[model samples]
Target: MPHRLHLEQFGPVHALPVLHYRLEFAHLVREAVRRVKPDCIAIELPSTIEAPFLRAVERLPEISVIHYEGRQRRDGAESVYLLVEPADPLVEGARLALERRIPLRLVDVDTDSYPRHVEALPDSYAIHRIGLTPYYEEYRRAAASVAPGREDRRRERGMAWRLQELAKEHGSILFVCGMYHLERIKDDFGRPQAAPLERVRRQGVRLFNLHPDSCREILDEFPFISAVHELRRGPLPPEPDDRGETLRKRFSAFELIVGGRKDLPAEELLRHAVERGARHAGRGEEFPDRQRIIFRLFQEAARHYRQETGDPVHLWQKRAFFRFARNYALASGALLPDLFQLLMAARGCVDDNFAYALWRLATFYHWQRAEADIPTISISPEEIWGGSRRIRFRPRERRRKGLSHLGFLKRKKEKRPGEWLEGFTDPSICSYPPEDVLIEEYGRFLKKKGAMQLSEELSRTEPFTSSLLDGIDLRETLRNVADGRVYVRESQRAKGGVGSVVVIFDEDRENGNYPYRTTWLGEHEQESDMAFYATPPEDNIVGPGICRCEYGGFLLSYPPRRMMDVWRDPDYVFARSKPEVLLLAALDYSPEKHVVHVAARPPRSIFRQIAARMGKKIVHIPLGSLSSVKLKSIRVLHILHGHDKRQVAKDYIW
Candidate 1:
């Protein structure tokens, strides 16, 4: 609703005072200006700074600041800077007036006399739900309850007097000021009492460029909100719609951050997430509310983090990470976390690289770099955006030659004869092999996941209660409690231990990245015999001869000596693929009836027939079904020099 000025002495001017924090205010002011089309526009800023302030507005999306020295009081010097952000409503409204060539008046007292006060106010966004009149009424009532400040009343009367003079010059006008001062300004309109505008000595006025990274610090809204405001090239509502714009922008950002790698799966995952969130929105409501949209984007980014680095971020972990982010926002006196806070929380809760994914998702705005020909000045983003930090960069000294060292200059060279060193590559000297620890841990994890599959295969029978079968079925018993009956369970004997295990990361011909392959003999006689294909540890020596290798295909069979080097065995020539040979070898070595085959897909019918011929059944466990992160960790194995090196290896294995 338009704010009508009903003063008998002052003509028909709309006094439109607006809250400055939200992007909605920019839109509100824009609409008000278009609708009223008043004969003249009156703004709250002083006439002296108006020219440069408007110039700063023209320089955006290349942000600039208006710096002017305030009245030099006897106590100290004071200076004021008006950050010309894209989302400021007063600036936006003024820009519209200038564009339309409306006669404009600067009505408020100059900056030198303006008094600043602190007040904790409710969220300005609530005005989107409630009309401006109601919001102002609530604000006015609250103000009346508290003792008014002398400085505030003086400022209101000054503005009111200025508005009256402006109304005398123009038939109708629009006055834009702070919401807190408008009610009192109206009460003092056309009154004989007038507050004298203070005049004092002023200093140099200048404009400074604002860095893109510093936009968040100086702007009223979060960096992400400013980013969105820029992307839309206009103000967005409190709860805006997500029409795949975020997905497209984030994907572009992800590609740029990752150096132009197109990730179709990640893109599809985010698209599906947005679609799912849209389904939960109310009818006729904007699909995928902004908050929900951001949540889903973060979730999809986490999933992509897993795909890229083999680190799974569980749903609970995501929840906890955002909880920390929100807390950071609250500590910073913001309603929600900005991109910087979210990235900081993600890095602490997740990993350093994982936060990179979130940052890419959050800071991307399509219109950030417009092709406008506007002149821009340069300033370091660090100088403005460095929060609570004082950073300085200086030229570093050049590196000196090694021989330039004073001690090295005085040293003399000594020669020694070349001789063979013992135990350099001997495997027997290693006390504990890292492969053994990795295999044992991985086998434990596989067994845990496989237990569920085993239970699914088992049959449950309901008969007269005998002992507890599979531990008393508490859920079943509780369901029948009202019927006056107690239910019990029977335990079944398991077939055998997880004796034979085959883990294949990728199908044959797909293991291009993992080129180096080898088989290692078990250092411990009690441990399971293993034969596998992996990246050679010798290629990546972490410590001396200790090398890290990723397993492309592996076979672990318990009861030492049951498994042989399937890679070297010539009798397995009938197998068409490398993984097939491992699978065939696992089946041939397994003394038990079933062999666990973990891969993306189940083995072909020929492998099943071959296993059946050998009186062994193959238990197919989809590798994708298990946690990729756990599997990736398990696949990483370190090769030690020898068994004698076990003590040293133990320290580095974990």
Candidate 2:
């Protein structure tokens, strides 16, 4: 993170205008001059992009190019957009020189040498050779990456030489290049200049890095110019409410988080974050709507609190007694709090825990149904409604923000609700329970808020109790089972089959009794509660974690974990049980040898071997279990990749 006082947006210095999505390198070069005030600015752009740079420094102007060459394409259309042709970075740096009346310079390969750095020539490296000096090995590798055609690249390697040569020339010369290649680079010819930098010290050349802030600004100013910059767009997007500015400022935080993976540059991490946010949104149907609503509530509350207290402090009294606020003058990247942040931020609003609960529920939906294509919705000003003097609840029927599994599922449909709900009148009925209960009853809450759109088909039809219609309407019926009048029972005729919902009592018990309150087991459990409780035969057994079933697929624990073997073996099964998580402990042998037990069935052992060999490739078990027939015990998350000595040997290579 740059010092808060030292942030800037880029545009060409003295360029005719300022336009959104127009400026590029010129803006960056110009900003560097002001914020860094570095004696020298070294850039990392390719030598080929250097010529036009000279023109800008020389104060020469040219026409803009309308076409973009090779930006990424989606749906076969151009993804990179350029509002105005950018004055290359070289030209921008040079122009800055004239304005500041300082020396401007370019650092690149000396075209005369086929490859600028000796290190670049792997076979010809001095360090790897017999008794070659470390200096030669270092220089050899560094020079190899420079463009084989540029000559000035020598400036980096010949730093001592350049210093002595430029002793006659006074003042600092800044070198401008792209940020990506900066770290991988070394002084030209792989020279070790740090010692020389301390002992000899150069007069004309001074090196300073153009950081993430400036980098993001330059990239933010225009459309796609490189794959690297594009990656910074993450899970959440910039909002446009009062909270929007603060949210944007949060985006500036990089060093505090994943700074260890330098290989996964800041830009890449940002892009991943944005995608994750989008994925979270699109993962569920209720998320986009719920996130948007809460964000609106936050924005409204934040703005109002700021006005009352004359400070922009966070007030999360509930989750933690924590509150944070930037100087009112500072810029924020987001208009609303993130889902996590909002959990705490809600304390500033109502005393009730509903806001926090709603947010958590949405989080659970994402974690549980991670397999679903849910979309994440950024809580933007447009999505918010309550901020107005006359507050309203506008349930957007449209798809939500960052794409998630649910968002994907909803978007894939052609339905026309949740896009935007503008005109809703208060319904006279109050028989339906609260929004929380609805979501608890049904898989997800209807779109957003307690209000659910009763589809013409499902709502008016009379409830059916016939076994023939049960399978087709399982999930839907499970939803309606919340009504106390409905009771799901097993058919008396079949041993392993299910029946339908039948009224056990003539009168209603309580306002409503959700039948599906307990988690459903499986296909068998849906039809018959007995199927849910049927225990594995004592002689044979049931194991935990993933076990290649005697039959085809895999099995998992129906409810939460309540096992003894899971305690003994930690690796047998994954216990958290994420979406479609297979709890194998249920099938693993607890009392008998699985091999002997299944010896009655040969294919099962074969299947287990195949599954073990393949691991995740063969099957995915969110909850795992292992059964030891000889030990007569079942273990969940108890097994490692059952030994592949050859693969393990290869994997352990240091």
Candidate 3:
């Protein structure tokens, strides 16, 4: 059996040693304080920096770090940092003490003489399985292997001495210190040895809020863990019911950001995630590490991906993604990958959109408003409402006086001034890769809709007491077991192939509105030949010469031929408007007898007559019949005319 540490056993001075990296430890500390109600609280920070540190703690949700620069033993400079997030045990302890009107003492050795060495600690989550004392024992073995030096011993003795003095005044005093120093402090509990103290001049000391981007580096837990800790106001409990509530609350915040129905509860999703995480971790005597919650989040992301793309994440893909994430975690020097690492892995293994969903779900909790009075940093205009502020610890570099005029002039100049044409490039020569991916995705959507539209008239009836036979409807037969009757109905296999499609987004003859027309040869033979007439790219530039334009009309010829040049074809000159030209070209190039036309209405009589002369037919499908949002997305296509633009196209493409 594993041994658990008991705080009450230690009498007036109950030493609760903690490993800082695990958020669970912080919660444990908070629980101890609540149970013991110590008269005075002693934290493991130096007395010299209590004011600024406490001030930063008082400002809770606005995460801040203590930055101090002190003289080195050899005479140079050494920097020390301590991040104070709401989940931090020391910060929480201090806050609790302050809230309860208990005296909070900073009792560790001064920062200048504090041991600067770092040792890799065991995973804090292990405490859930092996119990606290056993985990601490393991940690002690790991730290002793590294061996403490004179400075380490001095710091321990000094903290011990401080605790001894505090116990004399307060009936019950609690001391929260590093796990490695705990055993040593107990050994020197009653000794009357002179404690070492180094009183160096206080160097540069400033308090700066922690930047969101740097949270992964300085914080002990995943941002999601930190977020949940903030919401629950403690570490996650081992009980299934409590865990479910916490998980649901976290995902509920995520759902709101992703535009889920405001009234719909996220409990079902959270329940599914927890069950799956437990399964994945394998059942044993110990509970799985809390990191398993990440798997649940990815599952949620996968569901979202299916909803958006109509595809499910394959089993192999999920395995590969976790493997890749683990490799990244190892590279990041962490026992498990956090959201940042997971996002990076997702981008490479999946796509940006999938990774983007994961990021949104993980970060949603950070933006949620605290229901009670909690410490939070002031929001900035750029941070968005309910969003954490972006800050940096590093000082901003001062610009030289000589270059100040240029900055002043740059600020004075209007951005994207119509008068300034120097930076503007030809739209036909530049490309936006993302726009290309969007167009491709929209094309796939169109193909699916066209197939469905071709079979729109056909209806399926099963469990045949009613209609003619098509096939044995096994699904209906299984569903109606009470009747035990077989049903069948009329069915037609989808046949009308959409060899070519012409889309006239602007049904009206507004030819003058679309000033630019461009033709693009497909990069590969499998792609379609395309010609489009839309707004001039130069006037609506997104990047350099890359411009976004609405599609007045377009022609798509599949199994593209090198001779397919619809824009310059004199055969289409007879057509009056861009839509007419595109319709004519689509009818002419379609290999199939019928062509799909997506427009406000059927083509003009002349175009129909031309199609009839060529022994071809047109299938008219209203533009509104298809998803408007999807069509609108594809209506805007980017054109790249030069090699310079095409060379870098892959970067912008998904």
* Per-prediction TM-score to the true structure, in the order listed: 0.55, 0.23, 0.49
- Give a tens-digit lDDT track for model 3, residues 1-654: 123344523447888888664666676777678677789999888877888888887877557767777557576666566777776778888888877888999887775655444566555656655668777767677776667777778888888787778777988888888777788888787676465565433556677766555553345565555655554553343433333232211112223234322332444443333334444442443323466567766876786554433234555557778999888877756667766678777766655556765665554433323332333233232322123323222211224476763232222221433322333455345435566566655655565666666665565766566554777777777788789798675667566566677787774464576778876656666467777788665543333233346677777777765436677899888877778877888887788766778886787877778888987767778865565436645765655545466564443222
lDDT of each: 0.60, 0.27, 0.62
Q: Stretches of candidate 1 above 4 Å error?
A: 1-11, 71-76, 111-116, 129-134, 169-172, 190-195, 216-218, 234-352, 359-654
What are the per-residue Cα lDDT tens digits for candidate 1 across 525-634?
65776777776444434343355556778887767755556777887988777788888888877777778889878989998898778877788898756764356557
Off by over 4 Å in 2: 1-28, 35-53, 56-91, 110-168, 179-472, 477-654
Q: Mark the 10 consecutive residues where model 1 has the least summed lDDT.
A: 412-421
Candidate ranking (lDDT, best to worst): 3, 1, 2
Q: Report the Cα lDDT for residue 162, model 1.
A: 76
Model 3: residues with Cα > 4 Å off, grouped in runs:
1-11, 72-76, 113-115, 195-204, 211-218, 234-289, 296-316, 326-335, 356-654
Ranking by TM-score: 1, 3, 2
In model 2, the Cα lDDT at residue 39 comes to 53
